[model samples]
Target: MKNYQRYTKMFSMPPVRSMDWAEKTCVEKAPVWCSVDLRDGNQALIEPMSLGQKVEFFKLLLKIGFKEIEVGFPAASETEYEFLRTLIENDLIPDDVTVQVLTQAREHIIRKTFEAIKGAKNAIVHVYNSTSVAQREQVFKKSREEILKIAVDGAKLLKKLADEAGENYRFEYSPESFTGTEPEYALEVCNAVLDVWQPTKDRKAIINIPATVENAMPHVFAQQVEYISKNLKFRGNVVLSLHPHNDRGCGVAASEMGLLAGADRVEGTLFGNGERTGNADIVTVAMNLFSQGVDPELDFSFMPEICEKYREFTQMEISPRQPYAGALVFAAFSGSHQDAIAKGMQWRRDKKCEFWTVPYLPIDPADVGREYQTDVIRINSQSGKGGVGFILQENFGVNLPPKFKEAMGYAAKDVSDKTHKELKPDEVYRVFLERFVENRPLFDVSECHFKQLAGGIEATVTVAEQGKKSVVQAVGNGRLDAVSNALKKHFGAAYTLTTYEQHSLGEQSTSKALSFVGVEGDGKTGWGAGIDEDIIQSSFEALCAALNNLFVSRGKD
Candidate 1:
């Protein structure tokens, strides 16, 4: 903070009032996604990937629907040169898929780069030179004309070599560090390179604009991109591209805005893996379009598998909270969030809605191979009744009554709080069984027999309490009421049956019945659940369990 005066804005705004891109709201379609993972991401890694890993990553890129991939700077290292040769010698490059290689605007590097892709069916020989004012003044220490000549001479060499080799190789040029360069000057250099290539509709040339350091905001970059798009020569045949880094954490935003500004392609790495902060995340950029009802043209349906393989090959860890792909991105732990999500899911089931309009979720987790039970509504001390009930209903076919769900939620949360850990679904189920289903510390029912009467039922019940058993009889309007009366008489218990509900656990006729009961006694409500092959038996057990809970609440145990 004290040295803030030492820093100044290095980015230059475009010279014209090019604000047409601001009228667009979102990226309407997918861009030509060219992955630089092997070249940009691999170089950023602490340990660069082996030749085998690079090959596997290339295959992965092909599977993910990339038409253009920058393999590496083949002129930079023996490893890079050998990797390109391997792809060509083994015929690994597909006809439809174009492999791109990078080179500086120098004759030797440009020649070596062309040699590396000799046998490839389709390849883009990408050439770049720094055109930023900082690079000219501090790094290259050259004049503007000298830099323009560098790009033009390299373009001429590319054209000459392709004619001699009789290969229809496409050409791409990048004004490196374009963010720091004057927008008009960068356009001048790109147009000069385009003049040398003289690209046609059949073989369009690429003019890439890179935010090498990301010194400005996304709107500034979008304006600059618009200026270049409108003023560039061979405008119809040029494939306008953007390559953005994440130093300012706006790589994805800048890429999106640049596309809206008429850029046709994006060069990035998966998961934003690159030097410094990393490159723009192609996954995030693509998924952003996918979430907006645009087809991203890439298959991320098995995101977990992709994340695992990416980590294994790169030896990098994916954050648990990474967007769309992290472990916890879809996990809802807050009580309110879980409750809302539970209701939203029920609404979908009831209405059979075709659209994804669920609250608190921009996209359906299931759309990305994640599930509701395990991924959406997770249980913790902060979980609520609806979430607890949802877990039971989804996983175990036990739909708790609304009032009982509150009690169940408290019970599960208490366990999780005491243990200082999140409760798994099975652990929550076990808690339910221990507290509400098999809970009989003071009393148990051995058997019951009923006899019909005029307008009521008479029940003879065998009650076991503190190692003692007794038979008590009472009359009531129904079997459960009759049993309740008998128990109150035998134990002198005071309680009212506040709630009773039952449902079949399965669709089959012989499936077990599940019953829930709630008893209000001593100004408090206690709940219980029971399951049996017979509905009557399950109801009876439910009543007994509820009364037992009441007794414990009243300190009669």
Candidate 2:
């Protein structure tokens, strides 16, 4: 029976073809960073992280590199207000990093939010109010004229408070849900706020136009931002920002499109952790820049650590497949993907990349923190010769003969069909070892005698090599060592163990340990792998397979 089209789908990842977003978006250095962990992100979290969790999450974000962090709305709660005051009283505020406090246009909360950041070295009072037609009718119950007054009066009050503080205070304001708001009305409210704030060229007013619910496609988001940036007043002293959520899972794409349109800053959480579907994945967005040969301006490689810290603070699980920061983003699972990755890595080793062209990889894992080279192997009905070939190439440094690759693949299929499942690690290893190394039937009941004698364990291992030679043995630290030493005597020291590494071959403690070791003899290096419940026996046989590689390499030489 022919297999279904499973492996056919992985060949079309976006990184394989795109290359222009980086050059256009990140050219301006030192862009403003507005973090939404408190307001936008926290609101989306399922549990709405506790006060302690919120404070810890904020501290980690501030520590990572964000200069402007939106600490929660003090007017919303006594608890939140106390948290903001705690930041100021503890003097955690730095000279370069501005403490940002958010509030609505309502006078009481707005003033209270300002009071929360009163004694900071540098600060930003980010006041926001809903301006979309739906929000105005449903939430604020205000018309365009009424919303304009709310925005203008709030900006004037914020400007006055910053002036009174006599410190380096910056002002930023967003017309909430601006993506759906009429362009003319949104621009009017934004320009009025900019006029009231009277920002200088040195400290441009940040105009954040949020696709609050992410109702628009990426192109539409870009168009909306472009429209506003062109129409907004104080173009010289204006920073266009976008805070698009991932209600539709296109947060990263939308953010990229917005940046291309005219956004100077994009606010998002690390793994797009936020309300609903989460915010735009800043991780993907930033790494896209790195992949395109442009500096992303921010050092986001602290990704895993940062995400782990996020997990600790928010008590949330970071999905294993999250982009750039996920556990498995850099890992390959299919045979074709693994082969491509292996070749790409080899090409990159030369270190003189003309433009970072490699298959199945947009950014190197090393640039982040992933270091393990793995292509998750599986025994599905659709898997091909490439899978076994990769194991030979990657685990043993052996490129199988064309006939060997196809024959082994059929062997795997036969075993899989019999077992009604994919071949387990031990099963896979045994097939190859018997053919080329141990020279014995993997399941043959060979007699093994072990005795703690002399300086170490003495082992005599005897078996019938399925089609080639009789079982031999070797000796070492323990039973396996003795068996290996005994085998070497007869095998003429074909290969010796340079290093032995054992890890769970798959997701089972009951699963056999898979062993890989380096071998050197006759002036060359080769690797071999074996899997078995008996770890020592597995290593012994695997080393024998590696040694046999000497014969193949010698012929090639």
Candidate 3:
């Protein structure tokens, strides 16, 4: 935090105010996405992916709906050269997908790059040179005229090579580190290159402006993009692109702003894997648009599978909190959050809502290949009654009464707290079964029979306790009340039947009926559940279970 005077902003704004981009609230459509995973993402790895791995990654990019993918700098090494040759020789490149290869703005490299893409149906020979004040003064030590000549010579060679090779190839030029260059100078260099290419409506040129090192706020980058977009020659025939790096952790923001500034395409890596901090995360950016009702054109429905494969290929661990794609992105572990999410989900289902407006979740997890039971309402010590109840009803078809859910939640939380782990859905169900459902330690009801009376029901109950059984009879207003009275009389018990509810567990005539019962005694409450084919029998059993729990709470078990 000390000696901050050593650092100054590396980004320079275009002289004109270009807040017009700010007028646009959101990106209206998907940009032409180019995956640089094979080139930019691969080079930054501690061990770059092998030829086989690169092939798999390339196929993945194709599957993800990318039409333009930067394969690699084929002229840089034998591996790179062989990879391109393999794709070309094996006819791996699809007819619709255009494979791009990067080259430095040098003649020999340009010549070798053309050889790599020689008989391709479609390709983009991307050429770039560093054009920043620091890069020129420190790395290149070349004047602006010399830097401009490098780009111009490269453009001329590409044009000459395309003529000699007799291949219809698209051209792409990048003013690498364009953010640190003066906007006017960068434009000057790009327009000069465009002049050599002489792009037209039929064969357009691409001018990619890369934030090689982010050194200013995102607004500055947007302003620079707007300036280039407005002043570039052959503007209607050019595809303006943005390649933002995340040195300032603003790559996605900068890319969004750049799109709003009239850039047509985006060049980034999945999960933002690239040099330094990384490229703008194309997944996050695309999903952001997808959430906003724009089709990102990329299929991420199998996000978990994508995450698994990405880890396998790149050997990079995605943080659990990574936006949209991480393991715990949709997980609601806090008690209040879980409660709100549970109610919101119920409200959606009750209202038959067509849009996803769940509380605390920007997008539905199910929309991205995640389940509601496990992915959304995860159970931990910090979990709440609503989440616990949601897990039961959604996963196991056991819907507890609202009051019983609180008790069940407490029991599950205690287990999780002591064990220092999260409780899964089945584990929560098991806790419910052991604590409330069919729970009888002091006594068990072997059978029950209800008989109609004048204005009430008479119940005959057979009770078993410590290997002994007894039959008792009593009368009440309802069958369950009659059974409760019979049991209390036989055991000398004293408790009020405060609540009872019942419902069918499944949608069939023979489906089991689930019953919940609650008893209050000595300022303490006890809850229980029962499931049986007959509602009457289930309620009788529930009454017995509730009595047993009441006995336990009174320290009689």
Candidate 4:
């Protein structure tokens, strides 16, 4: 294998032998999506999906409205043969569905692949052999002329076998690495195979051309499609299919470009999970059409469910951030991102599902299996009010007043400055309620609490010394300053009230209020809060909460 790092596919497999140029126009039409999830996907699995897994996956494809699903290479194993038998005996194959199997042109494997397809209401026997010069010279050890005879010989055998078994089987042919094959010879060989099968309109043969190794760019793929679409004598008797891998990480783009070039069908696996790098990501390609207002016609509402089952069956990891179908694909962690998404969601809803245009969003989360809600309440110092408010609304269903939000924003800043990380949702709630909304704390502090030592005057403050107690009373501009000035008096000149404010707290006129105080004790900003039915009492309580906040900031456990 060539260093795939330097090339697209894993190996220097072959160069596409040039084909005779032809002029053909692309005919726009509805696309047929053929899922190769079972075979192509299975090859990439660390532990191949079991027979049960194949059966389950096959059924999922059928249930999702796939009329043609390539079940497996039945001739490859006893287990695969049994799975095909189970699909047949259980009457699971939909009448309109055509069960397909992969096999080489070798008589026995083709016969065996067909044997597994027997008794199906409708079936397709897809036979292929590598025909490129590289295959002939290196892999197959034969000339192109000899490989053509082998392929055509295989087709003849398949035709007789299908007639003998009394099964209605359609023939599909591919030159394994079709893109690398000489175009004139490839068509010559495909035409030779078609002559043996003699396809009628009702049983049109599917000529599946694979960009098997992504040796060329997309426009080249277009030219190849146009080449065959023009030269084929019986266009009505041909179903043009394209199977492109993601070795170049451009499978979806290549597939779309192929469709534009007149491909009638596409073959791919979900999440692009297949052999080396992966197959074309049908989910992304189809959903890309969805975003463009074209009906992808495939319902991916159960996309995550499909992904989960495939991961379990195939034992392949799907990146959490993979496009459209990953766990974190719709998750927003940045504050700006969350804000934009929230606003976009609102605008989309308000436009009556019409006038929505937003940044950083291609499709709505709800279009796939995603929810706009999250447990992400942690807003840090770097966060904005929008993020903090969102967390509060999600976690506590709390509608914060504008001022309260401002206070909590500072609190979050204080915490984040220490931790240097976003505060978790629970932490945000704890800090908000601990300092601002709640009027009372659960316990008494050593330095600050209501006491008889201060005479008839009541007050609260924070003290940091272990087992230390000191009380002082002082007159100040107001009740808040009086209490704060008392803390400075006790803690010495190092501690003092910097600023304080009180506001009416409750719904009724007779209802009391709450207080906020800022102290620069020890030369750092310490803001406190409290609310109660009594304005003065509320002020004292808030001053104590601020003091307690200082204690908390000192790493109190």
Candidate 5:
């Protein structure tokens, strides 16, 4: 907090205002997605992926429905060059997919790049040069004219080589540090390259503007993009692409705004894997569209599978809070969040609604291969009754009575707090069982026979306690009441049967009935549960369990 003068803004705004992009509320369509995982993502890893690993990742990109993938800078390394050759020779590149390779504006690298894609059916020979003011003054020691010629010369050479090789290879060029370059100068250099390539309608060229190092707010970048989109020559015959990094944590924001600025394509990696803070996450951008009712054209329906493969190939761990693909993205551990989510899910089911309007969840977990029972309502010390009850009903078909859910929630929360860990669904069930269900400590009913009477039903109840047995008879308004009266009379126990409820466990011919009972005594209450094939027997067992809990609560057991 004391080092106030240590930091300063590193980026500058464009000289002109391009506020048209700001009027758009959201991206109305999915952009052409290009996965740079094999190149940009792999190069940033501490241990770059092996040749086989790169191949595996290339296949994954195809599976995810990426039509254009930046395979690698083949001319940069033997592994990269051979990886392209391997894909070409093995026929791994699909006919519909076009592979893109990166290269500097230098000649030998460009020549070797052509060699690397010698037999490719379709490829984009991407070339780039730094055009920023710092690169001109500090790194390249060249004038603005010199940098502009570098891009022009490279563009001319790529077209000539593609012509000689008799291959219809498309071309792409990037002003490497577009964000740092003057917007007017950047447009001039891009137009110079466009003049050389003479891109046509069928063979459209790509002019990728990369935020090589993010420097300013996202709106500034959007202004820069709109400038290029509006003023560039051959705009209709060009694919304006964006490649933003996350130095300032605004890659996704910049990319979205860039699309609104009339850019046609995006280049990013899964989970934002790239140099430094990483590239714009294609997964996040695509899922953002999917949540808005636009089909992203990417198959994230098996996100868990894709995540697993990504981890195995990259040797990188996906953050637990990564949007849409993380383990805990859909999980609600807060009491209030769980309660709202539980009520929302029940509302949907009750109304048989077709739309996804669940509280706290932007989209249904099931839509992305996540289970609500396991992934949505996680139990912890902060969990509440609705979540606890939802876990029971969804997982094991054991629906707790609404009044009893509070007690069940307290039992689960206490166990989780004492253990200092979250309770799984099965653990929650076990806590419920140990604390409330079949709790017969004071006495166990060996048998119970109900007889019809003029005033009410009479019950002959046999009780077993401490290896001793006794039989007693009583009358009440109902069979459960008669049993409760008989037990209280035999043990001199004084309690009021306050709550009773039952439901069938399943819809089978011999479905078991589950009963819940609550007894109030000594200014406190006790709860119990019982399940049996016969409803009357289940109610009798429920009464016995309640009596035992009452005795335990009174310190009389």
Candidate 6:
């Protein structure tokens, strides 16, 4: 903290007031998404992807609905050059998708870039040079005129080469460190480049504004973008694009704000994989628009598949906390969050809601190939009754009674707390069976008989306790009540039947009946569940199990 005085802000603001982008609440539509994963993202990796891996990634970008893809700096290396040639020679480039290649604003590099994209169905030759004040004074040691002319020459050569090849190949130029440059000067250079291309309606040139190294807040970048969008030449024909880095961890925010500032395109990598903190995450930005009900025009419905392939191709790990595409983004481990989510899901089902307004979830997990049982309601030590009950109902057909779910919740949390691991749904179900349904440590019911009577139903119940059997008779209004009375008489126990519920496990005629019972004794309640083909048998077994729990609570065998 003491060294903080060593640094100062390096960004420059636009001269004019360009705060109009601040008035927008959200991005109204999806921008033209261009994935730089093969270029920017791959170069940042510890081990750059091989040619085959790059090819696979390119195919993936096309499948994900990207219209423009910045393949790589084709003039920089043989591999990059060969990758573009591979796409063009093998007819891998789709008819609708345009492959864009990067180059320095030098004659030989510009010529090599043009050769790299030869015979492609559609392509954009992108050129850029450092235009920041620091680059001007230190890195390039060039005046503003020299830098602007470099961009202009690159633009002129791209036009001449395209004309000679009889290809209407589009042109794109970037003031590479746009964020660190004076906004007005950056605009002047972009206009100079645009003048050479003379972009038309059919061949609209892209003027990319890259953060290069993010140095300011997102609002500052948005204002700068607005200045360029307002003053750039051939505004009607030019596509204003934003390429933001994540130095301040505001790449996605800057991209969104840039779109609000009238930029039409975004260049980013999937999951924000790129240099330093990474490029703006196209997935996060697109899904942000999707969550706001705007169609992002990209297919991320199979997000898991995309994440897997990204890891395999690039050897970069996707963080478990990454937005929308992460493993635990939809997971709710907090007890309160789990409870609210459970209630919200039930409310949706009961009301047949047409829109998603679930608590704690900005979007439906199912919308992106995630399941509610496995992905949404994850059971850990912090889980509660609602989450436990939700897991039972959603994964299995076992819906615990409202009061009994609380007891089951404690049993599950105890196991998870002791094991120090999250419990899967089936493990939770096993906990339910071990503690409630199949539990009979104190006693078990061997047999039961019932006879109809005028006042109530008479029941003859046979009970087994520690390998001993006993028979008792009692009468009550219902079969379960009669059995409860019989058990209390035989065991000399004191308790009240506080809860009873039942439902068929399935719709078939031969389906089993499941019953739950609760007994209150000494100001505490013990719960149990039973399943059998016969309703009467299941109810009796449930009563017996509940009594056994009550006996155990009183320290009786």
Better of 2 and 4 by lDDT: 4
Which window of ten consecutive residues has the lowest lDDT sum in model 2?
Answer: 9-18
Residue 13 error for model 3, in Å? 1.5
**For candidate 3, lDDT tens digit of each residue in 416-524?**
9999999999999898888887688898988887789898999888889899998999999988888888977987878898989998988889899999999998887
User: Can you write out model 6's per-residue Cα lDDT over 433-468, one digit (the tens) per residue?
Assistant: 888888899888898899999999999988887788
Candidate 5 regions exceeding 4 Å error are 1-8
Which parts of model 2 are misplaced by more than 4 Å?
A: 1-31, 349-355, 375-435, 442-557
lDDT of 2 by residue, 329-371 (tens): 7655455775565566557777767666667667766677665
TM-score of each: 0.98, 0.70, 0.97, 0.74, 0.97, 0.98
Local error of candidate 2 at residue 227 (angstroms): 1.8
lDDT of 5 at 493: 77
Clashing residue pair totals per candidate (backbone < 3 A): 0, 18, 0, 2, 0, 0
lDDT against the true structure, per candidate, is: 0.92, 0.69, 0.92, 0.72, 0.91, 0.91
Per-residue CA lDDT of model 5 for 259-290, tens digit only, reads 99999999999999999999999999999999
Alpha-carbon error at 228 in model 3, in Å?
1.0
Expressed as tens digits, the lDDT of each residue in 413-492 for candidate 4 is 78887988867778887877766645233223234344444334445555434455455566555556656667656645
Q: Which candidate should be chosen as best, given TM-score against the real structure?
A: 6
After superposing candidate 3 on the true structure, give the runs of residues whose Cα lies further than 4 Å from its correct spot.
none
| lDDT of predicted model 1 | 0.92
lDDT of 1 by residue, 9-75 (tens): 9988888898999998888889999999999999999999999999999999898889999999999
Task: Please identify model 6 stretches exceeding 4 Å from their true place.
Answer: none
Error of 1 at 217 (Å): 0.8
lDDT of candidate 6 vs native? 0.91
